[model samples]
Target chain A: MIAAVLLSLWIGSSTSSIAELRHALFSPDERVSDIAIREIRWPRTVTALAAGAALGMAGTLIQGHTRNPIAEPGLLGINQGAALAIVSVAVFSGPLQPWPQALLALGGALAASLIVFGIGRVDGRGASPITLVLVGAAVTALCAGVVSAIVLLSEAALETLRFWQVGSVVQGYDSFLALWPLLLAGTGLAMANARGLNALTLGEDSARALGITAPRARGIGLAAIVMLSGLAVTLAGPIAFLGLLVPHVARRIFGADYRWVIPGSAVCGALLLVVADVLGRMLARPGELPVGVVVAMLGAPFFIYVARRRKPVTV
Target chain B: MSARRTAPTALLLFLATLAVLCLHLSIGGTPIPLPDVVGSLLGISPDPRTELAIMEFRLPRSLAALCAGVGFGVAGALTQTVARNPLASPDILGVTNGAALGAVALLALTSQVQGLPMFLHAYGLPIAATLGGLLVSALVFSLVWHSSLESNRLVLVGLGMSGLCAALTSWMLTLGDVYNAQQALTWMAGTVNGVSWADLAIAPLVIAIGVALAAALRNQREVLALDSDTSRALGMDLGRDRIIMLGLATALAVAATVIAGPLAFVALASGHASRLIARSTVPPVAHSALVGAIFVLLADLAAARLFSVVLPAGVATAVIGAPYLIYLVIRQTRVRSA
Candidate 1:
């Protein structure tokens, strides 16, 4: 699915104008279609794919670890944390320098996850699914408040960060090139834990009986969550609904197997985002809607249907 | 159950609310002493500046907060009781987001309608929002009707509906011109800022109607909270009562959302707080009202006075209330584990 999306994006970029496309491919003219493709479309596609996959993996890990069908990076406040951090950086500092924002976002996401995890875990026991969700909601609300405070304080900052906060992909493409290593590391970690995650799903006691250390499994799961969600937020400004939507679609198509579900989610997420981005670009004609808005438009109703249909999975 | 025993708690809560209201009136960038604030309220000295600050600015805002908070608290209580889910609230029932979306849509569609009397415009938004909320509730209730309104499922459905409403709102904003988008965004954040006398007037009537209805069904709600089977066994019309309660709750939620964006966590936190304070199986609605009023009044005051940056009261409540919610969740988990 991801490959198809990439191919389509390439075709879409190339098909805008044959002469411009030829110039972009072979010409020294920086203003031609070739530069647009290589600099803009290519980087945008890569960022979307990386971010979507990371979000997908993160959502899957959250749902699996918590055993909550509704769990997602957004639900757990990771995205809000990242967004808040970015907003702070923009407000206090100036125009967004990419690497710093990414690092700050990563730290913020980790901090939020840890805080939520701590709140969810009471009396030194594993957290309940509902408890985790509610705690996440609370934390997210607080983070949103902080974001609002910052926005209200600085009109310039609000103007600069508002578009990004709303989940646009039009920001510095050059910055994304620097994030490849982080994305690779996170993706690798997530993939490596697929087997452990599979075992961990068979109830903690059963997993322990089968020689899987439940604590170790949970630790690894947390690491995967932090890495994937952090990286995803770094790449795209907290695009919600996709993380929740993609994994469910993957589970339905590929069954409950983690190996399939995880990779399937990544593929579906990438495809969904690319399509959403493309649709966003096309729908508005001259003025483009953000990919995040497009994804929400697509995902919300589907999310509602799935949520209503599924029985609650108690952790 | 002794009225005499309960009197102190009620009195304490009322006094606390009044104190917060007084503090709200007194504190701001231009601080007024409590005595002068009191004088202005009593109409003794009749200071025009104080009157403008109190009646024009603080009064409307405080009233907005009171109305919104009460509406949310009662709505939250009703929702939790009807759904039999501690997590269930107006936001979980999609009422808040539905109202927000409807309001946003109206704002987006109507360009020249901004300067009109706020009451007229406000009425449109809440009505549209309530309709949207009702549509979602009806849909979810029907969907889950086959297998009972499972607490978790109801919440999940509500969350999904919220997301959907939010998406539609975002889409509308994106389609809108810059000014419309700005207005829509401000409305979405659940701010009590810029509320006027007109806004205040609408809320009291809507909230009063909702409160009257909720009060009438309070006994039925309490009975229903004892479990549907028990209520049914007692010859109560459980379904009819549930529908009425749900409608009343949704209406209150819509009215509150219209007055004060979504005001995150108030409905959830206030209802929970009231239940905890009352320590009752069924939520204490009157206590919830007091708590809600106090909570919002304090939140607004904090936003107006405490913060160097002028943050919205909604934002302040979330900052404070969310931590408490987290504590509640963790505490609940511990209890369940034990």
Candidate 2:
């Protein structure tokens, strides 16, 4: 992941040699290459790293707690909820900085999760994973519908929204920086709860026998997920499937243990997103595809493949 | 699933449609008095202004909404019956996104270094959209058609595909210049704004044929909800009928998108609404169509008048429809559990 991030930082529209990259890193001077590396490439790479890692962790926590392999922030409507909140600020409130916007986003994500979970659990047996997904899809569509309405009604909102609506790691150095502390706190919380989560995965009855209070552990897991997902979404709009794909990849590499899966997910997601971003930069020369779009283009096929090859998804 | 259509329910729906259609025709960016609207319709209005508004603007727009609504409503009903799932509307099933993506892809390809070739540009969107929708239906049908179709997997996979297509559309927009992006985005937002006589031309013909095709296959289409052996015993070829039903549904939805830019919820809401109004588990095709038309017309009316700015009609429908979808989901879950 570190190598991938470093590689992304060096290569973009204007390629800088390793020597130039080293010079930019160590003996930074007022050179065009140095400035590009310092200002443009570095921040973009870091933003992707932070957002990707957070999303990957959030997916891990969400899937772990939900006991649903397909669960992710986007599929759970968490990201849309956060984005809707930020967009609402852009539309209704005067204007907010990145810090305040992200705070608003966290609140929004929490609200959406409650609604989604509430709707899902209405089934009486608790909402099945499939049910949660279906309800989440509906909620995401609804939020997106409302967001579009807000954008259409206000010019000021549109200017900010059109770009954000499509998730990207375009230009948000401050926002990304704002997320760093929360990301650390959330990651720490997730890692701390990992051992309990692994036990909880044995089902609530077994988890209770193992002396893990299932509900309390699940609550911690949800909070961590909300923090990671909300902040990531606020930093970059909503990068679809990052959370869903990464945990699976992580588990493939490191096994189902939450301790290994969490960090592994962070590594895999950051690497994947950074590479996707770089590839996106290369794909459209003067212009660029959003990293989110590239991820979807790649992830959608993978999603189908997984859905097809696996056991029929159930509760 | 079929039940007797109650007279009072039919009368209620009929009156609602008539009243809304009248309201739709009589009002616009500027409201014309009811007398002037009727006078213009009868060619007896003294004012040329009233005639122009009625003929050139208001009439075409309202007609487009009604026809498109009916098309979407019928399509929604067909799809729901075929899938045996009320949630399987064109929009939810990714047909709308597929059509929109196909149309936008065509637009982008043609408009790329130079604008679209005039012939393709002028006549291309509906064709592209319909073909796109058909393609998606084929893919969706094949994916879920494991000896027998599984509606659950179909909806799940369809939702995934819809999101994927939307992402692809967004990518295409990003690659295109700003003006094209704006145009495509507005279309995807789904609106009947600026619909004209030209826009309404192909829809009526296509819808008429599609509805006739659906009616002809109505018995076989309903047999879809039956198990394959029973349907076979009943002289229905499950595969052939399913394809024909899906094809017709896709065409109707494509027709709706052709006029309304993939308007949301009408397909889903109208089907469910019509089913309730007709008091049948089988959504009555005619009732669904009528209810759909009334729904869109009313939604458009709210969008145009209820807002300080004219909002897209799709947004209004979604605002009303999505919650209803959630409610339906909750209710369905409850029923199943019970």
Evaluated with lDDT, which candidate comes out highest?
2
Stretch of 10 with least lDDT, candidate 1 chain A: A6-15
Clashes of 1: 2
lDDT by residue for model 2 over B1-338, one digit each (tens)? 43354556767888888778879988777888887887888889868978998899888888888988989999999989888888888888889889988888877777675854688878887888888888887887787777335446677777777778888877767665534433665457677777778888787889989878776776776678776678889876777777888888999998888888777789999999888878776787778888999999998898777767878787778777878888888887888888
Model 1, position A114: C-alpha lDDT score: 92
Clash number for candidate 2: 0
Which candidate tops DockQ?
1
True contacts kept of each: 0.85, 0.51
Interface RMSD, in order shown: 2.5, 1.9
Model 1's A-chain: what TM-score? 0.86
lDDT of each candidate versus the true structure: 0.75, 0.80
- Off-target runs (Cα >4 Å) in candidate 2 are A15-19, A160-171, A313-315, B1-8, B113-118, B178-182
lDDT of 2 by residue, A20-119 (tens): 9999999999999999998888888888888888899988888787777777787888877876787788886745666777788888888898899989
Q: CA RMSD for every model?
A: 3.6, 2.3
Q: Residue A73 in model 2: shift from native, Å?
A: 0.6
Model 2: residue B295 alpha-carbon error in angstroms: 1.7
